[model samples]
Target: MQTPLQFCPRCKKDVAFVAAAGARTCPECGFQYAVSEPPNPGSFPDRPDRAGNPWLQFLTIAGIVVLALLGAGALLLGILFVGCALAFRG
Candidate 1:
């Protein structure tokens, strides 16, 4: 059996190519059909683990150091408050 020719949605005429290659331009009405893949509906892991760039690694380390310094400062403040309370009690 012969395959039926695919019709262009705009002009209702047979399309040139079977698989939508490039833009589908309608000869009759000059309507342009945009050729794009359908979106993948399934969720998938976007990130893959690998050795990152050296500059990126350095920035990440710098961020970690800043966070650690903030945590240390909070701990030091708590210790100073406790020591001040003990000294006042004496």
Candidate 2:
């Protein structure tokens, strides 16, 4: 019986899958197809092992720093205003 041809990376061409001894193989190069399913294309690994976008992280951190600086500036200005008011009240 004939089978559909699958591309063989080792053989660099499409070849028929030959079934023998319960395993499918490339006819020309004798490359065996794995029984297990391959991983999906462009899939992410576990969170710890996966890489995230560096630019997004950098922007998030930068935004937080800017907000924090603004908060600190407002706090300092409030303190200065309170001190000046007290000094002139005497």
Clashes of each: 0, 0
Tens-digit per-residue lDDT, 7-54, candidate 2: 888888988776544356887878987634334446523441223567
Give the clash total for candidate 1.
0
Q: Candidate 1: minimum summed lDDT over ten consecutive residues — where?
A: 43-52
Error of 1 at 26 (Å): 36
The lDDT leader among the candidates is: 2
Taking all chains together, the TM-score of candidate 2 against the true structure is 0.45
Q: Which whole-number lDDT from 0 to 100 does residue 14 have in model 2?
A: 88
List model 1 lDDT by residue over 1-90, tens digit each.
Answer: 233355777777785533234454665667776655342345421431224356888999999999999999999999999999999998
* Clash pairs detected, candidate 1: none
Overall lDDT per candidate, in order of appearance: 0.63, 0.72
Model 1 CA lDDT for position 66:
99
